[model samples]
Target: MSHTEKEATLYRMSTAEHQCPYGLKTKHLLKSNGYTVDDQLLTSREETDRFKEKQNVQTTPQVYINDKRIGGYEEVRKHLGKPLPDPDEKSYQPVIALFAMTALLAIAASWLAFGSFLSIQTVEWFISFSMVVLALLKLQDVEAFSTMFLNYDLLAKKWVPYGKIYPFAEGLAGLLMAAEFASVISIPVAFFIGSIGAVSVFKAVYIDKRELKCACVGGSGNVPLGFISLTENIMMVAMAVWMFISMF
Candidate 1:
């Protein structure tokens, strides 16, 4: 059929009490695709239920073209030969949010403690708090985090228990750094883990040339396994070295 002849009939739920976002999206999609839509609004729960029963469909936002069923948003995309966005697609949003929040908290704490927002102390606090936040994200689902970590971490691959202990160790190091106490333990811990992490990431991304997800924040994270992961380890190493120098 010609583009001008292409037409769609959309049936969706719209009522005084509620409006379906999916329904709105479907209509917009049809219009964007150059289809003239015959919009059918089911204004009540009974009307929606009856329509579903009559159409033998379980969901709202049903679309049709030339009396041929095109389905909902997902199926419509498929019918138009468009790739549907994967729900499990990787994203850096979580890590970005964690770092942003940590920076804000660090600035607030530094202002309260040292009366300076842009001090060397603020950078220290930011790294420490960021580590703590990242560790907390992993701790939320240790099992999942460990599974992802084992994909590339040398220590985790060999000694599975290291994966389990990693979050706690990171959190302990972060807490110690934040409190400016127990440098004797925290320094070595941070240095050791950071060194190991740096090596593992280098081998995975550089040497092996593998495209993988980072388990730095958590197992479910979509953070890429390169720059951000390396930066995190480098921050730990830097913090450890700084803390050690401050001690002597």
Candidate 2:
């Protein structure tokens, strides 16, 4: 066949009641890739079902190149040699959202408590609130969190139970600190865990040059093990030390 004669066919749903987005996307993709498309629209539910039955396909937005079936959007991309992005790709979005929300909450709380939005108390509350949020994310699925935590946490790697208990300990310390109560236990807990976490993150990302997902939020999170993880631990350690010094 001549290059000028190259043609593709697309079957998509475009009824009076509904229009398929995938169908539009597939059509756009084909046109952008330089294929002349013979667009076929199924105008009714009955017509769509019949087309699916006749084609022996289960989904809409089916494509054909030179009369050879090329499947849907995903398959078409593969056929065009473009790899689909991984759905589980690592990202800092989850951690970023968590910290942002925690900071906002801390400001609100500090204002209510001391009539000041920006103060040493606000920083302490921010750290405490962040710990609570992170703990809750881990507690959502303890088993999953523990598995991911073990990947790089020095204490969790050595003693498996530490992985399971870490979330609860973090939550307890955060609650106590936020309320300005039980500093005796909360300060020590935060210091010990935060110190261990800082060392572990530094070793994993800087010393060993390992690439891994962070369990600071949870196992399902795609947060990378690097600066964000180190920052979280350092914040906790600083809060613990400041609170401890104030106690004396």
Candidate 3:
């Protein structure tokens, strides 16, 4: 009887050169031991951002056994002596409900905070800083999207990954957030934010083809991009109009 070769595990090392020496070694050794290898080498900041979003992993050198993490280098090395079925890996959960709940609450808090900060210089700083942040994120998203055109199967053909898109959408959301901070813009801002929230709720339910990750209201990670984007834009425009009305 012929024996079947064990399936090679999947290991993702950090972009950092040092954090995953063991993972690299494991890849090499696994090949020697007759197993296949898949490597997710992240180079762009946006790629790193997507990995973070997908895994909710804060650090790099994340190693996975067939999609499960055997921890990092040390952990993998330690388990090297174990049998092929290590049975000691963790599964990655894409949608974390607790995180999603926290995000919703944070968005609510942001509206209140921005509303209170409008009279202060923080509004200007938040607007400018938030734009810069979102712009950088958008640039990264564009680059990632372009790469996906050539490798559609590897990456979903979405315009941008959810992690990257969230920040882009947030740019518009921030504008509205900023408007809410102004005393003259309060009612408009409230209405705008409220509108965004409503649309977000609707989108979360209605969008069928949506695969984008939610980056709304503190990374609540639930709202869909379609609804949230529209919601935020509406709020911002409404706030601007309300600011005009409040002036009189």
RMSD of each: 4.2, 5.3, 14.7
Across residues 109-190, which tens digit of lDDT does each residue of candidate 3 receive? 4567675423433433333344334334445555443342222112123333543443444455455445445444444444
Q: What TM-score, to 2 decimals, does candidate 2 have? A: 0.73
Deviation from native of the Cα of residue 213 in model 1, angstroms: 1.2
Each candidate's lDDT (Cα)?
Answer: 0.92, 0.92, 0.47
Per-residue CA lDDT of model 1 for 198-242, tens digit only, reads 999999999999999999989888888998899899999999999
Give candidate 2 misplaced runs (Cα > 4 Å): 1-51, 60-85
Higher lDDT: candidate 1 or 2?
2
Residue-level error in angstroms, candidate 2, position 120: 1.6
Q: All candidates' TM-scores?
A: 0.76, 0.73, 0.29
Give the C-alpha miss distance for residue 71 in model 3, angstroms: 9.9
Cα deviation at 15, candidate 3, in Å, is 18
lDDT (Cα, 0-100) at 210 in candidate 2: 99
Best by lDDT: 2
Candidate 2 per-residue lDDT over residues 1-248, each given as its tens digit: 57744578999999888999999999998899888999999999999999999999999989998778999999999988888978789888888888899999989988998898999888888899999999999999999999999999999988999999999999999999998899999999999999999999999999999999999988798889999999999988998999999988
